[model samples]
Target: MKTRILSLILLTVFASAAPAQKNEQNRPPIIDAHVHAFEKDERWTHKVANPLTGQPMTATTEQSHMQATLAEMKKYNVVKAVISNDYQAVLRWKAASPDHIIASYGFYDPSSQDLAFLRREHAAGRLMALGEIGAQYEGIAPNDPKMEPYFALAEELDIPVGIHIGLSKPGIAYDDAPKYRAALSNPLLLEEVLIRHPKIRIYVMHAGWPMLDQMVGLMWAHPQVYVDTGVIDWAVPRKEFHVYLRRLVEAGFGERIMFGSDQMVWPETIGMAVEGIESAAFLTEQQKRDILYNNAVRFFRLDKK
Candidate 1:
């Protein structure tokens, strides 16, 4: 009779909790940790490879792309996106919808960026992040001397950084960033920097894919480091992505992984990135919720907003 009574109580508790759980699961807002916005007249456009054709994907006009991005954000329930773009361009886009965009300083050359300007923007609440600091494209590592100032600044200010790590698309060497180095993709190389700036909120942009062991080692050693599923979430071959992601999840780092569209010129890919995380067969419902929304919220402190 005691056992029967206990079971009834347990069922009653679960029944009462079910609705709240379901409501929370349905549509929690997302924080897309990595994305870039391009102006139409700007020479640079966000590029994505066609998974099917192995060819370049074209984007509509810059105006159309921005419109599509915001629309998709609404459709996907993404409340905020961390945008990496030129300083003025970031200002223009964020000014249009200040609440929705988290301004990030996108640096091509770490040595060339104006630290003073960066600090000012960050101080003004116009910039909250410091990357897509793509040194790998220049055959540079995250720990390169040129990167020290930028990393140090982020650490000093307690701003989150989303750095590029891991492989670039195949044949990227043929593109403008010919100096791309595959070896620099290793997440372990960031150790020195991590050690130097222990308190800085940092997340590897690609989650150091194809370097899973290294990334796992990095994560195991440094609890402060986090990651985002950018291109791999949408662009990589599904099986390859899943194998790496499954191992990461199983190894007890699921809480640290966040979602990023890496949506450069491709606005439509935003939904694809969301679908990639949502469609993962290995992740449970709760795990999906964490990856989709909760984890990023914690990483960026978006809940405080």
Candidate 2:
């Protein structure tokens, strides 16, 4: 009689807890994989001075932009955002929102100076990943010896590398200005580095831009390769961008695709993209979960806690 009663009690408790557990499991957490933030600075601007064009960037305040971002995240229930920025701003966001921000370092190019700093930061646990690094339209290469140290350290530490491919700012000098072209945007160029250091988690940002289809192929070929949908959605026409992303999902690359607003433009833009992904007909509920949270959680090892 005592054993029967104990068993009955446990069953009763589990039966009552089932719905709550299901509800918890059903609620998907939102994560913005591509994000940029800045500190309180007087001279910050989202507009980049086209080095190639020699045009100046119109300065804008980051205060309103950041506030709007936080509000949007709250609206969409975004649990966290993987944030990157120039050295100063990254540190500021980390300090301000340590709980919600996963900080990363940026490499302008394959410069020894930048590589040394990132390598040291990576070893010290100051940055979670290495990225927005790669050959720009200007025809720079990342595997140069200067970038080798950073790559090696990242490989050793087991952090993902994010590369800003496809689209980039023009050159400062007109003669040497980087041109946007298919040759410069090829994902195959990364094959050498990927084959050389297979352990490194490399993410092709902007879904490799106008080369999304090509990038999908690259991700298929390389188990360790991944891509983040950054400003592409907002930057491109909605109808066409939707079709492009749909093809990515149809190709079964949804899990490998990460969600990011490329928040350089604005914080609200981040919320809109998250909503777009959530409502996407191509992605099932569980698939949405993977894209928004699980993928990042696994890619970045956020659950190490």
Best by TM-score: 1
Query: Can you write out model 1's per-residue Cα lDDT over 42-154, one digit (the tens) per residue?
Result: 32223333343333434445555677677777767788999886556677778877889998888766767788988888777778888888888888888888888888889
- lDDT for model 2 comes to 0.64
Q: What is candidate 2's lDDT per residue for 1-305, written digit by digit as tens?
A: 00001111111111111112222233456777777765533223223332222233232455554555665666666678777766567766667667777778765556534655766776677788776664463356544455567677778888878877765433322333333244657777677788788898878787877776677778788977777877765655566667878888788777887887776634556655775676677668888777777777778878622
> How many residue pairs clash (N, CA or C atoms closer than 3 angstroms) in each of the candidate models, in the order given?
1, 3
Checking candidate 1 for backbone clashes, the offending pairs are 46-265
Residue 13, candidate 2: Cα error in Å is 57
TM-score of 2: 0.76
Backbone steric clashes in candidate 1, count = 1
- In the order shown, the candidates' Cα RMSDs to the true structure are 13.7, 15.6
lDDT of 2 at 286: 81
